[model samples]
Target: MIRAKTILALLSLAAPAVAGDIPLAPPIDCTLGETCFIQNYVDRDPGPGAADFACGGLTYDGHKGTDFALPTEADMARGVSVLSVAPGTVKATRDGMPDIAMDRPGAPALDGRDCGNGVVVSHGEGWETQYCHLREGSVAVRKGMRVAKGTVLGQVGLSGRTEFPHVHLSVRRDGRVVDPFDPASGPATCGRAAAAPLWQNPLPYAPGGLVGAGFSTTVPGFDAVKAGLASPATLPAGAPALVLWAHAFGGRAGDAVAFEIDGPGGARIFEHRATLDRAQVRFFRAAGRRPPAGGWPDGAYRGTAQLMRGDEVLGQRTVTLRIGG
Candidate 1:
């Protein structure tokens, strides 16, 4: 028998004019190399503080939207488009803001314009959605344009108050915030689920996971990552160091972190292990070395990172890069 949620999704696609119920798909394709993660959810806490649908520390105080973060600044540079979750007419749009990550020391302050290059769509009957932190020139739709589910609205960016590259999506009804994960509109108590879910298939939120992983010939800063102002990927033979780094979120004390690097010959060139002494929202680690008196061999190189709790692995990522012409 077909599930009711599946039928609802089909109905939303077939009848875009329908009001009151709009099914949502992922705003960005995570299957692509753009392995994005949810940094925050609409604050469910009522008392002027913060809380996520899962009641985790993944969210910050007063965060009123769902944040989908790209792995690195380089990924933002390559461009990843954000999609509309449902059909609607564009109500408003803001563009031309520079894609500047706030992590830089001298980054300009946006102040009141924190949404930064955004698009809003009204789904009728007071229902609306907002997509923010879009690339300067990536807005594809203008005000009053009819857009369907999965329509490309803009590219994910680091344009607003965000220190990382991401797109923040906000859903509202009559100007009041709504938690799509909790349709019944109650606190998301641990192990106690809401009676109703707004989403046909709610996006899963993983608290602790690898946020970014990549390789470089030179050590990169939190911003100089591929998505930032990092060095070229093509490494000359005998370069100083062929570094592999990984950044993560939701790390806790006692967790084991591991790193590995393999060269063109498929040989493990370097490996290291470490333990976390405290929790962190953003964690970074790397492994590399200068070439022997000779230099690096010409070919592709691979890097892998893992986070383990006891013997079980909590998160992991692998990335590859080409060396030489």
Candidate 2:
């Protein structure tokens, strides 16, 4: 297998360097501890097989960009900036694309011309980057405008052919698609990829793991949560139902999963524990409970989930919701 260092050496010997090491910065300003994550990366394989930045199946066929996905549209509604990764001039942009989540009924159908509100910037030396799925009306720069690295271009959104809230950043060299994580910008074999990564700092890549955890006023299906549907910001005190849900990808048959909801008063309102009997590309689990007859005490409700394999915790997430009114 060709290692990263080997790829870097080969690249230096084969051609002139492009100014210096990859001068790109992350396109988003979000923390990546447990909530926000890179859900997918540019697929390297030219065929139907999948591959991610770390040489995994976290990507799908024909996917040509890195998807920095957020937990929910509620988070997108709160505003998450998509930043410019390198100093460049805006070459093109499209805006006014409705920032409607895919699961919302009657969401407008998109065409090839609709990348759903995006910006394309051209850095020197034939390097161009495209940021896709920006929030409606959030394009901050116009064509021909100059921008510095880390400049705020817009907010991430669920637009175009997307099912989740994320900014799909596509990098290109001389109009050819490139994978920033791969030195040759080509397919990765095994877990080895070629030379210097594009990010100024190391960007963490998540395998098929926990995508998000959240509390909803109504029970949510797996697709609903992924498409950011019915995400309530605040739960009414007397609401009939409150559900805690989690979404995960690349689940194996023997994985152990747990979900729980805790009331404001620290009472465990709902809990579920199970072991998957079949492998799944994506899986979801939820547990819900209604408030007592007297009504829920207004404060905080916590939802938590954990995916386990034997004694090892593969992934875990926690979400808190406020109960008012």
Candidate 3:
């Protein structure tokens, strides 16, 4: 494991000859204690991060807080139990208050429903953490309350500005929401429990690896399929038969995966396709696991899935199967 002091020492050295260990970036004051993540892979911004979320197909003021997820599903639902990112005071809380809702399915707009049934914990030095999208009528604390880390803020849900159920975790400073994506672009507000630092690429750490960033689905080194069937136990006519399922391990809230499904005949069924999110988990089950909703007839089929970067393919794998009655 790489130590923080070594990283700092490298930063202090004149100029190292190592490839990835050079000193060019600025020094960031990373918190060595508490850490924070998006809960899902694509918890910040858009692109590969938002691939695994069913809500990714939608938009919100060109700014998406947590990744697209549906945390209230039966499979991979249930978002992370809201907690205090750091020691702070509850600045506000709302219960039974009507929140802003999305008008359409693809675009984002403004709604007064800020932090749906949520809380704002204020930290020292003008720092703060936000626990939004809480379960309706489940709030415990009131405004002006104090809380510590690991404190149960509320239950996760798909509240305001969301299409599916998920948590909307964010950090703020002096009333301004801070970016949790690029750690180098800002200061360290909390320590990370997943990765060593909070700024590491959130995709690779996603429940599954970054879609379009690495191999879409890993090929289990040898040969075998886990989780959902690649060809599925069955499929409907005209519907894409070749499908693959992936789940992120330790994935952040905003990470995404990009891949495509292909038929055994080499026909592309799902090009640049991606799974959906339901908050912290990266499993495709969050988006309704119905490869062929009505169930497909018996048949022989095969398919492949891969991650990509625009036109560049990263990781990939093949899935084969035979549908029987």
Query: Pick by TM-score: which candidate is best?
Result: 1
For 1-325, candidate 3 gives per-residue lDDT tens digits of: 2233311221112233223321111111112111122234223333433331222222233342443233223211333456565566888876663322344354334367755667777776666666666666667677788876667776555455544344565555565554443322222223322212222222222222222111222233211221112234544454543335443323333434444444445554454444333333323311112245655445555544443333433234455555553
Candidate 1 contains a number of clashing pairs equal to 5
Give a tens-digit lDDT track for model 1, residues 1-325.
Answer: 2222311222111322234655667777565223777777777777766667767666776777888888777777788999998889999999988887676666667878899899999988778999999988999999999999899999998787787788898988888887666644656555674444455564555656776777776667764543544434677786789777777776778876788889988998888887889977677777677786667888888888887767656577788877786
Better of 1 and 2 by lDDT: 2
Candidate 2 C-alpha error for residue 18, in Å: 7.5
User: What is the lDDT of every predicted structure here?
Assistant: 0.74, 0.75, 0.40
- Clashing residue pairs in all predictions, respectively, total 5, 0, 38
What is residue 138's positional error in candidate 2, in angstroms? 0.9
RMSD of each: 6.1, 6.5, 12.7
Ranking by lDDT: 2, 1, 3
Worst 10 residues of 3 by lDDT: 25-34
Task: Give the 10-residue window scoring lowest on summed lDDT in candidate 1.
Answer: 6-15
